[model samples]
Target: MSGTELTVTLSGATAADARAVVRVLEPAFGQAKEEPPTSEDVTVHTARFEHDPADRAAEPAAGGPGHLSGAVTVTVQGAPEAVSMARESLAHAFTAQDQGSVSGDQEQEWQLLLEP
Candidate 1:
């Protein structure tokens, strides 16, 4: 378990930020929760964009530019802290990287921001 806070920010013309966020948050979910300082301990993810880093990334992207806004919130599933950690991992990874959110929201494309 990693008690140390890990916050990585990515920027690019593409949705690279989302990809980067999910990548770093995966381990927290994949690991066992029996150990201390595990996922539930403090592992979580926040989603946001360049322009609006306060609200959750909304509507995938809609269809435009000159606007940067996204969603970001702490997630925790039922069970142990690890479970919450896993949820956060899923939320972050599943948000922009997963096909569900990406493929489903293709009408508009937006960047992602994952904060730990």
Candidate 2:
């Protein structure tokens, strides 16, 4: 992955719920490389996004609210700034509770519990 790339792993929810979270992030990070999940049975879904530096200067798009069938655990891993930006984007669109984080020399991983 690129230094400016973010990988979002969503679990503890259905595929639809995971896609809902992705929809909320699309405006902030541009389109994700993964397509929407095709099976409802899947409880985990992953999406990858490459951050555009210019996006940091622009106003974050006001994403509409998303629906979740149940609480979802979202983990965002990437460069520190990229992870922070994704956290902010998710906060704006969901009821997110911090679930701790871990950081390395060049990357950061943040986890959150999201609800409808």
Candidate 3:
């Protein structure tokens, strides 16, 4: 399907947060073309992971409300419909964990801020 392309970026994330984000995105993005087919419903146009290994050591251990000394930004771009689906999935994820996400829209780009 044809739709506006959009990017979602998550900032101030911990390794745990990163893992959570992937769990939510994987269903929307699906496996690489080389991989066997799975139960994904949407296909992502692009996905990128950003993080620094040096900062990993400094991050607080996963559990309870975590703190962020650094960030792991995961960006995903896809059609509007797919992006919307991803957003809903993401919302459910954070809500389930009692974590809150601050989102803003600017020039069709959506940014999500996560704690811990």
Candidate 4:
């Protein structure tokens, strides 16, 4: 199946999906032309993170307003080599023209049950 290819048309994506898509934006636009007024009609032919480290659900949870139909998560368990490639694509979409200061951590916890 590695020989096969898939395309993700991010044209009509909902706001929630846009949030998730932003992670892969950088690399997505790296190859596109730089024209006046950016085009939100972006497509990421190559995405990186299939099995999310966070909720493991890149798609919106069931019963949500923006549940992606016919949507499937690309499992990376079989091929560990694709992770880096995917990340590279996203980096292009995000940074766009400017390789801005990117220094942040993806935290797993955000609760405040106990005050430290």
Best by lDDT: 2
Instruction: For each candidate in the order shown, give its overall lDDT on alpha carbons.
Output: 0.31, 0.84, 0.40, 0.28
- Model 3 segments more than 4 A misplaced: 1-8, 32-46, 49-76, 96-107
lDDT of 2 by residue, 36-59 (tens): 786877768899988876655345
TM-score of 1: 0.22
- List TM-scores for all candidates, in order: 0.22, 0.89, 0.42, 0.22
Best TM-score among the predictions, by candidate number = 2
- Each candidate's clash count: 9, 0, 0, 13
The sequence of per-residue lDDT tens digits that candidate 4 reaches over residues 1-95 is 22211122333333344444433432322221222223345432223223332423332222212223223222111122223333334333332
Best-to-worst lDDT order: 2, 3, 1, 4
Model 3 lowest lDDT segment of ten: 51-60
lDDT by residue (tens digit), candidate 3, 1-116: 12233444444454445445655545444422232223234333233422222322322222333334344443444443444455555555443222333334522233444433
Superposition error at 52 for model 1 (Å): 35
